[model samples]
Target: MPAITAENPLALPRVAASPDRAAARPVLAVTTAPSGLEGEGFPVRRAFAGITYDYLDPFIMMDQMGEVDYEAGEPKGTPWHPHRGFETVTYIIDGTFVHQDSHGGGGIITDGDTQWMTAGSGLLHIESPPEELVMSGGLFHGLQLWVNLPARDKMIVPKYQDIRGGTVKLLASQDGGGLLRLIAGDLGGHAGPGATHTPITMIHASVSPGAEVTLPWRADFNALAYGLAGSGSAGAERRPFRMGQSVVFGDGESLTIRADAAQDSRSANFEVVLLGGLPIREPMAHYGPFVMNSHAELAQAFDDFQAGRLGTIPAGAA
Candidate 1:
């Protein structure tokens, strides 16, 4: 739960949005994420499961990777894999991970850090718990979001960005009841660090008990708020939501969230990841790790990857 914090939220820049504002958005849908196993047996909850792409255009999928506390020698990780035509944003809320890719991009992803990898053409990569964590065991919680590339930039180039938690812009609610971490994109004319090929806004907010957080949102971008911790309600409609749930918002200029008066010991407040992205509206042909525009492109990607055209494993590495 240590994904950036402030001793006094009131000291941070504030974003003003009133609950009674005429622009308050309404909740269109509330869905519970289904849990499953992923990448060498790590537990995951598919945040976009059962949600239509129309509501998530410019974004492919999202996985909430673990809130698990593993015992020694029990941690798991993903083997080498390939991806192309999109970007993968791996954000660690707790714990650490080491990632390596064929393009020579490698680093330790620590708590409250983000690894933004753009697999424009194609590349092979791996994500694993650090050896120390695997040996000693500890808490691991994170999220991996797949952002789709438009057809034009689908083959531009491959790149990576390491965004540290401290570098993100922190914002507070007008009443100081909520703390917001701006990871990527723009809010209230303030921009985040991670630059995206697509237009989108990524934020992590913690709302105090019985507190309300109202945020001004871009009217053109589709809005979403995924519950990461505690119980709360979303929208002016007041649909109740809790941990591991995703809320799809209808047209609006602002979002409203209220935390319950009482919360479990798991967290002190209602935590949520707010995402808003302009719809790409392009035909999407996706399979496995490749997201292309058509079946022919998909076949070509497979052929390219099989022939090692994507990339090779680093020397002396698995």
Candidate 2:
């Protein structure tokens, strides 16, 4: 066996589904957009943002950090910043990310690892490539999702959950044709490692050629899936999807995904990240990194950050 780095090393176990499972949901719509640079010139594709927040409630934003190969000594990433009244989730797919916060919470999330931070009351943090990676040159790809907090829990205490790649539960398809990595919710009878304030499910799945899997989901939840790699069909719509496409689903209790084996012998597998949650439905006010229920609250957050009340990173702690 080869050595296991911080990347994926666990052999996902296959999970069989009972023959009497319910029908899968249907696709309601498909969304495609271009990614732009943000956070100090890092390229990113926004899956959901601004007015789309109302459509995908509880999810403030979903950014696909476009894959980029950084030459040695290249400078990139988000510097010190402030956040209030929300959560920031960083899922690393192919790089090392070093993070530090004012609350003294800090860690490194490598390939396949995840860092879920709750900037409830307030906090200052920075996310950038580790110095070694920057100096040596490497590839970086990942996703950053912002989850909105309900009005009642907007000011709760800040917290962090850094989950390593191997710790994430992986379930194989009943027919041994696919795999599902449960990151933040239950799937295939296996629960994710992180605890969430808002009820939500975040899963990453890859299906092999001609294999299919049906995943049960909450009927009341609003769900969306982004194609990470390859092409395949999803839900009852069975619509053809290519890379970089985001598919929204209609109300249903289950979701089905299949791989198009005819595409290519080596690239026949389909990969995606499925996310959803119970809509919060509350009015939201967002200003840069701060998310609140009212303009007054948003203003206060800015004031606090400027006054150094949100805390600060220790000297030379980057």
Candidate 3:
């Protein structure tokens, strides 16, 4: 099979939920994009971090990284860093990212690939564009999400899941008008590739103009949708949203997205990312890259990193 690329979109037929579970969910709130800022070394727009939202529960932060084109030899990407007590999900829509971590984990995530890293106790890592990409220059677009672990599992061993785009289960719209790629958790009888410490669902969906899709969602889980490209109405409220908006959903068993039929040809294909997870309602004591339940634990995390307790990537390994 050919590599999945943005120009050659993927499509999965949408499977309808049972009639009894098809109640329409409405938009609870629409979050505007925050000011773009330089993170580590690249331009990023934060969608929801603990600082901006009252409670995103299990989710701590979401960063939309470059959709910007770069000329050859341009500076790009994040250097080595430390993280603890959470999982980082990197979904690449375009470009390539080479990742190396203290746990001896390393790989390249290209278009349609996802790197789900569980920084259970702690881990040092680096994510940057491949040298070739940096040398030749190209477009880069992706999202990095930080997911909090429940208190009990916070100190578990770190792990990594590098999932290929083609391996993700795809669900098609009944009318053949859209596709949904399930990266984690289950959707429409399809199970995702990544196993999680917490229950969560990550879906990337693309809907052609005039397509309508309804997906069954766990009513108790906190759910939100990020408009990736084009424009569409979400839920029964028909709240109109364009690219770059984040829409939080109200409590209901089902969620929907309907692409605008009148969109210009260039913008007719609407793309979105839907995320939902059960809340880990414990206290969160966070310090920079570390997240723990108490100040003491947070302090220990830093001390450990300083003492080289978290493993290190060998020189030249990255």
List TM-scores for all candidates, in order. 0.98, 0.90, 0.91
Candidate 3 TM-score over all chains jointly: 0.91
Candidate 3: residue pairs that collide? 12-171, 12-172, 12-179, 13-171, 13-172, 13-173, 14-172, 14-173
When 1 and 2 are scored with TM-score, the better candidate is 1
* Per-residue lDDT over 92-202 for candidate 1, one digit per residue giving the tens place of the 0 to 100 score: 999999999998989998889999999999999999998899999999999999999999999988999999999989999889999999999998787999999999999
On residues 210-315, what C-alpha lDDT tens digit does candidate 3 reach at each position? 8888888887787888877788888887899867788888778889888888665544578888898888888998778999999999989989998999877678
Most lDDT-accurate candidate:
1
The Cα RMSD in angstroms, rounded to one decimal, for candidate 1 relative to the true structure is 1.3
Off by over 4 Å in 1: 18-22
Query: Residue-wise lDDT of candidate 2 within 134-240, one digit each (tens)?
Result: 89887888889999999988899999998888888777666667677788977656788978889899988877667777777777788888887678888766887
Residue 166, model 3, lDDT: 83
Worst 10 residues of 2 by lDDT: 1-10
